[model samples]
Structures are given as C-alpha cells and as structure tokens.
Target: MTTAPPVHRSHTAGNPDLLPLLGRTPLARIQADLPHPHPGFWAKLECLSAGGMKARAAMSMLSGARRRGELRPGAPVVESTSGTMGIGLAFAGQALGHPVILVGDCELEPSMRQLLRTYGARLELVDRPAPRGGWQAARIARLREVLARTDDAYWPDQYNNPDNPAGYLSLAAELIGRLDHLDVLVCSVGTGGHSAGLVGPLRRRWPRLKVIGVDSVGSAIFGQPARPRLMRGLGSSIHPRNVRHEAFDEVHWVGAAEAVDACRRLARSSFVSGGWSTGAVALVSAWAAGAAPGAVVATVFPDGPHRYLGTVYDDDFCRAHGLTATAPATRPLEIPHPRAAEASGWTRCRTVVDPLAAPRGEAPAPHIPAPGGAV
Candidate 1:
C-alpha cells in the first residue's frame, strides 16, 4: 500500500506562521446576555498577539517584505509610532536580526517606552507638533529630517505605506471565516491603517458591510479642525493618506471621558484590558450594535491596558487632567446628551465641554483613578 508520506515536521515546532499570527485572535462575546437590544457584537482581541495590537500584523508584513526582497533583511529598520507599533516592529526587527530605531513624540507613555526598551529598540523623542500648522505635519517633518541624517535605515511609514493596509488583509479573511458574515466593522482611526486595511477585503466579500470609523473628538482626521485631545492612538491631528474614506459608511467621534468609562466597564465586567482607543471603539460598537438589530458587529482591540499605566490607569494623572477621582463605590457614568453629531456627519455622544471652544453643556463624567496609579 502506498503509505502516506513520512511526516516531516519543520524545525520551528509549535511556532506559528505569519498568517496564523495575523488572525484567530481571542474573540470575546463581551456583550452577550447583556440587556442591550442589538445584534451580537464581538471584539477580536488582537492585544493577545505575541507583540500586541498591530504589532503582529506589522511584523508579519515586514518579514514578508524582507522575504520578497522588498526590504533587505538585517537592514536597520526605523519607523515612528505612538506606542504599540514600535513594540511590534522591535520584536520583528530582533527576530529578523535587524537593528531597530524608533522616533516617538514626548506624549508617548512611559510604559510604552519601557516596552520598546525591553525589545531593544533605540528610542528618540521629538518635539510635539506645531500647534497651528498641525502636529502630524511637524512630526512627519521631524521623521523626514531624522531619516535624511540616518544611513541604511528603512522607514516603514505606517501612515502612508500601502503595506500598512496590505498587512491587514489576512485579518479580514480570518474575521470572515470566524463570523461567517459581518454586518458592521467598528474601528478607531489613527493612521487609518487598521480600518483601511480591513475594509478593502471585507468589502470584497460583504459588499454591504458597514465600516464605522471612530475618531477622538479633537482629532483632525476626517477633516475636523486640529485640537489637543486627551485620547491617544485613536485620532490624528491631520489627515492621513492611508485612511480609506470611501470604505467607511459612517464615522463617530468619541471623547476621552466616554472612552475611559468604556475601558473601566470592560475591565470590570469582562476582564478585558483594553487601551483608550479600543475603549472608545468598544463604546461605539456597543452603540452601533444596539442601534441596528441583527447586525454582527466586530471591532478591533488594538492594544492591551499595560501601556496606559501613567495616564488612563493612573489616579494622579487623571486628577491633573481634570478627570474624575477613582472611588471605591465608583460606577460607570452614563453619557449625557449622548447624541450630538459634529459637522462632519459623525456623532458625538458626550457633552461638549471644549476649553478651546465654549462649553456646550454639562461637564463630562467623573473619571475614577486607578488605585496605586501603577500599571
């Protein structure tokens, strides 16, 4: 009998391939059995990636590029990230035996810095962007200047790179397989990489799928005026070319307070530790799922809670930023006037108390500071 060919296992036993790493993230029915009157909403816990958030996909993209000769292996890899992406790149660079350098803004959290350092990446902090001209413009200029002075450095411009979107196609396929059908995909827009990347493939399969792009209230992305926002990793002060506007059926702008509350709720109820943007996206997902009956809402959780130790999770930082004090009997504050849409056709669910602009209504909910203030 023609016996089956002798099984020959690859050397990297128990090690997963790039495609597998890109998907099958823990899918939590965080909203199941809740009193919400919407279709089932699920969160693909990408924070469980080996590096966390977009890091796994980013690394896979870079590694694939190197294998295809798009990038030279062992070349010093340099890029700019607010946090999570840097850690991902650092992991990929180290694995591929490439030295990594990162350019970050001063606003980057200490925990993110520590993670990058642990991954052996050289960190360079640049000045915050110019207030009037746009922070991203200034930051990009700084990155270009750094690149000009550096030699043999590969710049993975996550903001404008096609690879940024290409890296997420596998995720789309995986989500499609897992959910069978997705009516809505909720994601927060930063560089627009994650949303843009997933939309293309998802649309090809589910042409009517609604892609809701969530931005922080102060983010200039989606053509809003630039303003300082307490929320990080979700909004941009400038429009990023990578954002696929056509792919989005609608957009929503979430504030920092609402996002923080959502984060706390997820932690308490589901034990899911999520970042600020992820919290904001979750809030939107919950809302959208409730708004549309029988809709399968899938949202992306970009990173874990470990990185926000100082700001979102810290008590002193919250008080300093006018956030609510954390109390033992604290409860999730309901969003007041949770139905204001901005001029850009995006809904603003919280009271608008813009210090730059006139206060529109009541103050935001009290922010409960985490005890011990350590991540």
Candidate 2:
C-alpha cells in the first residue's frame, strides 16, 4: 500500500510520487434481477480514488502540461466544469502546489461549490451560456477572460484536449487486468472522456467488444437537438468533440426518473452508485446483460452517494423534479443516430451526421414514429 499524502503536496500524475493516488480503482461485480445468465455485471468503483476517475484525467492533463512547459511553477490551474471534473482539478491543484480556479454556471450544486472551495480552488461563476455555445461556451469564455488576466493559468480543456482521454489509459489497463474478457462496455458520454478513453484500448484487446453508450435524453452527444439537461455529468447541450462516435455500437438515452430508479435499486441490490451518469450506465448495462446471453458487461461507476444525498437521494427534491419512481419513465430509447427521426426502443442510421451541420446536426433516419413525433 502506498503512503497517503497530505491534502497539499507537490506532485502530478507524471511524477512517480503521485501515481499511487490516481488510478487502479477496484472493479466490483454487480447482479441485477433483470435478465441474462452467468458472467454478470462488473463496474469499476471510481470513487475509491481521491476524486474519482476525473482526478486521473486531471493529473494526466496537468502533468502533460508541466512536461510541455505550459504550466509555470505554482501557477493557478483554471478550467470549466459542472462539478465532477472541477473537484478533480481542485484536488490536483492542491497536490501539485498550484492554485485552482473552476468556472461554471449557477446550476453548479452548492455541495460542489463548497467542496471546491474547501480544496482551495477559486470559483468563478458565469451568469449564463452564450447564444451559440450554451453553458459550456460561457464557461469557456470566462476561462479565456481569466487566462488573459493571469498569464500563468493552465487550462486543461477537458472537452477538446487529447490528454483528457489519455489520462484514462491507466484505468483501461486496470480494467483489463481485472476482467478475463469483456463483451459489452457500457459508459456515459459527457465530455466523452471516460468512454472514449476506456473503450479505445479495450477494443484493441477485446476485438469483439460491443461498446454501448449511455447518454441523457437531452444530450446532443448522440446528435439530438440541444435541450435542458436535468442530469449532470452524463448529458451535454453541446456535442463534445471528445465523443468518438465511431467507437459506439449502440446508444441509450435515459431520463431523470429512470436514472433515479436505477440508482436507488442499485444501491439496495448491487452497488451504491451515485451521480446521474452511473445510474444511466447501470441501467443500460443491466439491459445489455439481458440482451446478450453469457455476456460480461463492464461499466464505470464514477462516484459514490454523498454528493447526491440532497438531490437524487432526497425524496422531497425528487418530488420537485418529478423523479419519484419505482419504475422507469422510459426503458432504453435506443437510437441509430442521435438525431434520428423516431425511435421507441431500437434504431439504426446509415448517415448519423448531417451534411449541412456536418458534426452537430443529426439527419433524420426512419424507424419508429419519432416517439409520437416528440423528437
């Protein structure tokens, strides 16, 4: 066992001193009374790390920046995040002797704001998202403004940076070491870091692996029009470039109520997975296990329940959001493309991207009738 470092230390992922705190989270097997037979579900308990999987990416990004001489000694680390990655960066900054600044919109939960501040990160809040870019864009513009003011600030743009996904190479290796063979890999897509990071290397090792992406109903990552994302860390109003669209075989969009049900049931039956993305991933993983006979579905549970006690676990809060449910509002809305014309459950698209929009826009693919023309 490695010695526990203090909250404040001087190290990054590249430093031999900090490697022990970042990756190699435990992989736990979970069984749900859904479907399928043996070779049950396995999930990497990412909360075991200091700040979960995001810390690993933060370490990797900062370390790379240090090596490239992008980060000055004792410079402030500034970036935009909803909560998860923001806390991760704050933890990283504390360890590496750098001040951290996290920029986000008001929707950032109070618990996260306090946690980041407790870790010694400066918090910057943007009033709203820009007309074109949305919340993420507003955060980015705020980051740029901060960067312009502080020349020493190092921004690890998680959305577009290659190093963000590169950080999870160790996580991928750890999963490979634990699992004998992985058939279905279910993961949530936000900045698309973990899914792209883990699936890329795993696919090379397990040639027949089916990568199933779990996204929020409103997220544009799968090419749907931007909508309000009730769930955090899983959905995106703007399609992130980090999402390797080619890496996925099929995608499932889960809603808030379905996620709440999944989280509560998993906590009681299998693992206490917190966070919106983990619930979505767990729901899809259970479905995948039932869909494929004798398949071992590996998923990533990125966090624990403490952060969600006031919301996902709070009955009153759930009632406010109309998330109180013993069953799912929608079972998995499988779509061929993110912007497909219609789908009740399963769908497939020949051309997933729009030629005019090219990247973000979704061209229509005929399937079911747009979920009663809702899409």
Candidate 3:
C-alpha cells in the first residue's frame, strides 16, 4: 500500500538535493491596494520553485513511486502536462536521477521549454488540441505511445492518482500554522489536484471553513458544459477524477477578460504576480471577503505573472483577444452568468453539482465513452 505522508507544519528537516527548492512557501495578506473592497484577504503564492505548487505534488508522487519499486532507477518517467506540472516533474526527475519526457502542445513558452531541456527532460510537442477531447487527450495519446516503446517508464497519473492530492498535506499544515484562523479557501480547479489536496486537510482543522472553487467559464469540471477555455493550468474540459465534487461548498466561473484584468491589478497593487488562477481566485476572494465581512479568507495562487507576460500582461495580446483593462468590469460582484457574457466579472453557482450530469458516485472520467473521454 502507498501510505500517506504525515503533514509537516514546518519545512522538511535535513533535506538532501533539490528538497530545499520545494517547500516553506510564504503566504501574503492583501489589503486596500486591491481594486475591490474587502475584509481580511490573503493569497498564497505557489511560485517559489520553477515548478510552483505542482512541485509539491511532484515530490509526493515521485517519492511514492520510488518506494513502491514501480519506478526503476534511471527509468524514463513520462507524463502529459500543460506547463507547471511538466516543469515540476523535470525538477523531481533530476533530483531522483531519472529521465523525464514531457508531452504537451507545441506552444509551450520558450523559457519553460528551455528549462525542461536544461533538466535533461525531453519535450514531445503534440501538433494540436484534439477537436473532441482537446490538447489533454492528444498529449495522453502521445504518452501512451511513448510508454509502449519504453519498458522502464513510470507515469505519475496526477489526475486520478491518490498520491496527487496526498502531496499537499504539507501545504495544508503550513497554512494551518501560518494563519491564526482561515475561514474561507478560494482555489482554482485544473486537474483538481491542489484544491482537493489542500482543502480536505484544511476543512478538517477548520471545520467551518468554506471552500469556494474558481474555474474557467468553459470548464466542464463544475457542472458547466465543456467549451474552449483560454486560461491554462486552471480549468479542465473533462472532469478530473481528482476533483472531490463534494469537497466544494460552491463554485465560481471566471472569464478570460476578467482574469487578465485581475492579473494586471494584482501586479500593480501588491507587486504580486499571481498567474492565471491568481486573478480568478483573487477576484472571488475579494468578493468572498466582501460578502462575509471580517471573515479571514485565503486563496492559492498557483504561479506568478512572468509566464503570462506575453499573454495576460501584454496589452497587445489583451487587445487582440478583446481582453483589456476597460473591457472587463473591475469590481467583483454577485453575478452568476452561465453563458459567459461580455462583462468580465465573477459568477457564483449555488448548485455545486450539475443537475443534468450523472451522480458523483457513478463512473469516473476515464471510464466515460469517446470523443469527450478524459485522461
């Protein structure tokens, strides 16, 4: 059995190579500098490592693989990634003396692509996103082909694997010790790893803690039908098995224009770079604090703005996509738009589960039939 690691309130003691690059991430509390009004608002920046919070998940997954003997020494570890997780796995593979092969779309940033190569991880670029399943399915298909060719290949299934969520025990513990009390946790959903990973232990400690999940407007994970989503690393077209449906108290959908505006505002205010989810979560967190005054609310910022300079921060890109400062409503409000309207703002959904969708107890995404099947 793969045992869960105990939560560590402090940083790892006596770490060997690259372990120091992993944990002890510091959290920041936001204030009046933000464009919106709020009580106590806090954001946890996960951009400490080159890999970000996914690095935390990577450590636990790789460690478990080593212990299980499922991962052979010098084996070529293969996985499908959009960005952060790929960089994280590369960080881990180098530390563990294993080679890594990252499969993703060819549009990966030059900096990130070079970093992966620098870590000695081979980058396999898929030509395009599958019309049905999107880039995720295309990447997974490539991973399967690679795995078939390599006998000593270990794939860290971040979505469905129990080890993925189990990885964030330390993150929860860190938050528990850092904050006097955390009443609300606003997290973005992607593969549903960090939200499920961090929120579970957090609610256990703070029983009344309200978890509000932030996702892209087009993501199907939170009862919405799958549509093309511009933001990466935050939403999924296919519902990930890692998403603890019952875990979330409510869900909020944020559009690209609003997200980009939030990112720009974040940088100007606190000099904080809160990447893609940062903006969405921050927008919701501001509203969350406003909705319930004096409640200490915290949100996880998956990564920083450096990766988004060409996109989120670039005025040209924003203009080209019809996403600009004036394009979105800066003020966070109590609006819930399912169709994703022109006004870039936050939309709250009280119905946590999709009424039209199947029950949560039913089959997982991997078991789902074609064109829309998830990894």
Evaluate model 3: give its lDDT.
0.75
lDDT of 1 by residue, 131-217 (tens): 664555666676676666655567778887777777777677778788888898988888878887788888888889888878876
TM-score of each: 0.78, 0.86, 0.86
Ranking by lDDT: 3, 2, 1
List the lowest-lDDT window of 10 residues for candidate 2.
Answer: 1-10
| Model 2 lDDT per residue over 205-318, tens place | 999998887777656676655666678888786767788888887777777776777788778777557778777787778777877778888999998887888878889999
Q: What is the C-alpha RMSD of each candidate to the true structure, in Å?
A: 11.1, 6.1, 8.6
**Per-residue accuracy of model 3 over 1-375 as CA lDDT, tens digit each:** 122222112122312577777867879887643446667588787887546889888878988998999876667778988888987887777667677788878767777777778866788888888877788888888888877776678899888888898888888998999988989999898888888889878988899999998988667787655666788888886667888878888888787877776788778877876667888888888878888898999988888887778888887988887776354554433334233232223456654774235554543222111111011
**Candidate 1 Cα outliers beyond 4 Å, as residue runs:** 1-22, 32-40, 64-70, 132-135, 325-375
Is candidate 1 or 3 superior in TM-score? 3
Which model is ahead, 1 or 2, in terms of lDDT?
Answer: 2
Greater TM-score among 1 and 2 belongs to: 2
Which is the better candidate, 1 or 3, if ranked by lDDT? Answer: 3
The lowest-lDDT stretch of 10 consecutive residues in candidate 3 is: 366-375
**Model 3: what TM-score?**
0.86
